[model samples]
Target: MHAIDVNELYHILYTKLGPRHWWPARSTEELLCGMILIQNTNYKNVDRSLANLDAATNFGLAALLALPDGQLQALIRPSGFYKNKARYLRAVLQAYHDHYHELAALPTPSLRKRLRDLPGVGNETADVMLLYVFMRPAFVADSYSRRLFARLGQDAPYPQLQAHIAPTMRLNIAQAQEFHALLDDYGKLGPDVFGLADQYQLKL
Candidate 1:
């Protein structure tokens, strides 16, 4: 097997799928809220949950802080894990002011560490937020990413997968964001079963 060129994959997907327009956040606060809401859930459910929150609290940070836990849980029920998610969202809100700031003011490593220290933020989540929301150079290694890379004979641990893409590409914010989105959309649009082309152009 040959090595999978990360940039080649990125370009292939970009050319095939065009723009996926991912992350789906209009503001920094919205992105932070989505970071908590999107845990272990799909975008459809997250969109519904966000709509509920928007209608209920106008997506205001103070309103989110003011909303009772039970109410918060109810509003975000569409995304699942409502109770834990509510707590996680609040914890993120508590930390956002301190750890999050203008992108120019903070380094990627420090911001990533601070985000990871917060509850409910694992490696994948931290990297996603860094890459999409903070516009940093972090390759988000999700399950789809691993599966795609593995097919190309680049099987590795999560951090290793990130490393594999990080050095050669050094992808900027737009490219990194588009690459992640393309991987996810391609995985979903590709065949459900593995080891087969199944109407998709993604070669193994």
Candidate 2:
């Protein structure tokens, strides 16, 4: 155990693992698709699904919004749970079209509320979107984070976990983004494999 804080863990991971610059996308819509599609699945499948969507719509958000439900479902089928995810995507697009007159301009907290109000967006997804897309300093308390922290003798509900872990990491937008990516990516290196779990005991 390092007996460390979140900030120190971030530095260690950053030095060892290098930069992530995660949520790989060239546009907000692509990022939206990514955050939605990546749920309950890995990135490889999400990449294939995104490629299919690009082939179908030439990488245009308007074209995606106009795509029929069945076709949208088919294009993203490789991501698994296609029908539900298609509906989720449609709901998000519809929300954007109907109400996104100035959403990106809102404060991060307000933006998080709106994102969470959408059909499939949860706290984790909303925070990721906020951090990566809207350039907000929001830390994502995702499953990987929980697992990693549990191993460190710290486990709680999301809000409690957030309170426990966030204060130690004094992060701005870029640092918040990198910190979260490191927690998740390093945590994925489980005890049996190449992750951070087998290497250290984090009592803090």
Q: Tell me, by lDDT, which candidate is best.
A: 2
What lDDT does the true structure give each of the candidates? 0.77, 0.80
Kindly report which residue stretches of model 1 are placed more than 4 angstroms away from their true locations once superposed: 1-4, 102-104, 192-204
What TM-score goes with each of the models?
A: 0.85, 0.85
User: What local lDDT score does residue 23 receive in model 1, on the 0 to 100 scale?
Assistant: 64
lDDT, candidate 1, at 142: 89
Measured by TM-score, the strongest candidate is: 2
Residue-wise C-alpha lDDT for candidate 1, range 69-170, written one tens digit per residue: 999899999999999999988887767654455433677777777778889888888898788667786788888888877766567788877766666775
List, residue by residue over 138-204, the lDDT tens digit for candidate 2: 8778888887777766777787786566555577778888889888778777642444555656654
| Candidate 1 backbone collisions, by pair | none
- In candidate 1, what residue range of length 10 has the lowest lDDT sum? 195-204
